[model samples]
Structures are given as C-alpha cells and as structure tokens.
Target: MRRKARRRRRRRMRRRRRRRRMRRSRMRRKRRRRRMRRKRRRRRLNWRLEKRRRMRSRWQQRKMMRIMKRWRRKRRRRLRKRRRRISMMRRRGEDNEEWENEEEEEKNEEEA
Candidate 1:
C-alpha cells in the first residue's frame, strides 16, 4: 500500500508540471501574435497619414494658383486704364509746347 501511494503522488506531480509548461508556452505565443498585429496596424496608419498630407498639399497649390491669377488680372486692368489716359493726354498736345491747336480749329468738325 505504501508503494502504490508513492507512485500515485509522483504521477500527479508530473501531470501538474506538464500542464504549467503548456499554459506558459501558449501565453507566450499569444503575446507574440498580438505584438505582430500591432506593428502591422501602425504601418497602415503611417501610410494613411502620408497620403493625407499629399492630398492637402495639392489642394494648397491649386488655391495659390487661383489667387495669383486674380491678382494678375487686376494688375493688367489697371495698366490698361493708365495707358489709355496717357494716350488721350498725348493726343491733346498737353505734353508738347509747340503743337498747340486753336479751339476754333477743333470746333470746325462739330459744325460739319
């Protein structure tokens, strides 16, 4: 009876040790898998952020072009008005001292 009890106790201890080792290996495997999944998700987030930055930069470039075009058009219009005023003044001999025309000579065309 004493030998049978000793054998039974040894068997139970071996079983408990085996179970503990199995649980530890299983937990280690699960932890490694979780870490790998987190790394993949981080890579995906980085790609998405880069894509958003490229899109935003493109939009900013387009907006700047629009503003530049509007400013150029306004400058061109002002230059045209200034040139017209200068031409009219030159045709009236306002800038020339010897090219003066009589007022009665400019009124002959209105009578015709």
Candidate 2:
C-alpha cells in the first residue's frame, strides 16, 4: 500500500509539471503573436501616413503653380495697360521723354 501511494503521488507531480510547462509555452506563443500583430498594424499605419503626405505635397505644388500663373497674367495685363496709356500720350503730342525714362527703368527692373 505504501508503494502504491508513493507511485500515485509521483504521477500527480509529473502531471502538474507537464500542465505548468504547457501553460507557459502557450503564454509565450500568445505574447509573440500579439507582438507580431502590433508590428503589422503599425506598418500599415505608416504606409497610409506616407501616402497622405505625398498627396498633400503634390496638392501644394499644384496650388503654387496655379497661384504663380495667376500672378503672371495679372502682371501682363498691367503692362499692356501701361503700353496703351503711353501710346495715347504719344499721339496726343505730349512730351515723350518721361515715357522713355520709364521704359528704361522697366528694363532695368526686368533684368534684376
């Protein structure tokens, strides 16, 4: 009877050890899987962020180009108006020396 009892106790201890080891291994696997999932999620978010940044940059570039073209058109219109005014003044027999000086000034400004 004593030997039987001792054998039973040994068997129970071995079973408990096996269960504990299995639980630990399962916990380790769960932790690894969770970490992998987090990494994948972060990578996906990073890709989205980069894509948005690229789109935003492209939009800004297009906006700047549009603004610059509008400004150039306005400048051309103003220059054309100035030329019309000078031509009318010339036909009216006004002193054209002032207009010649203005043209020189405009040329210097454009060169700069």
Question: Can you list the residue pairs that collide in candidate 1?
Answer: none
With a 3 Å backbone cut-off (N, CA, C), the pairs that clash in candidate 2 are none
**What lDDT tens digits, residue by residue, belong to model 1 across residues 12-100?**
99999999999999999999999999999998879745555565577776776677689879866765665566567788768753223
Strongest candidate by lDDT: 2
Residue 55 local lDDT, model 1:
57
lDDT of 2 by residue, 2-104 (tens): 9999999999999999999999999999999999999999988797455555655777767766776898898778777777888888899897788878777
Score residue 111 of candidate 1 by CA lDDT: 60
Best by TM-score: 2
Cα lDDT computed for each candidate against the true fold: 0.72, 0.82
* Candidate 1 positional error at 95, Å: 62
TM-score of model 1 relative to the true fold?
0.39
Worst 10 residues of 2 by lDDT: 47-56
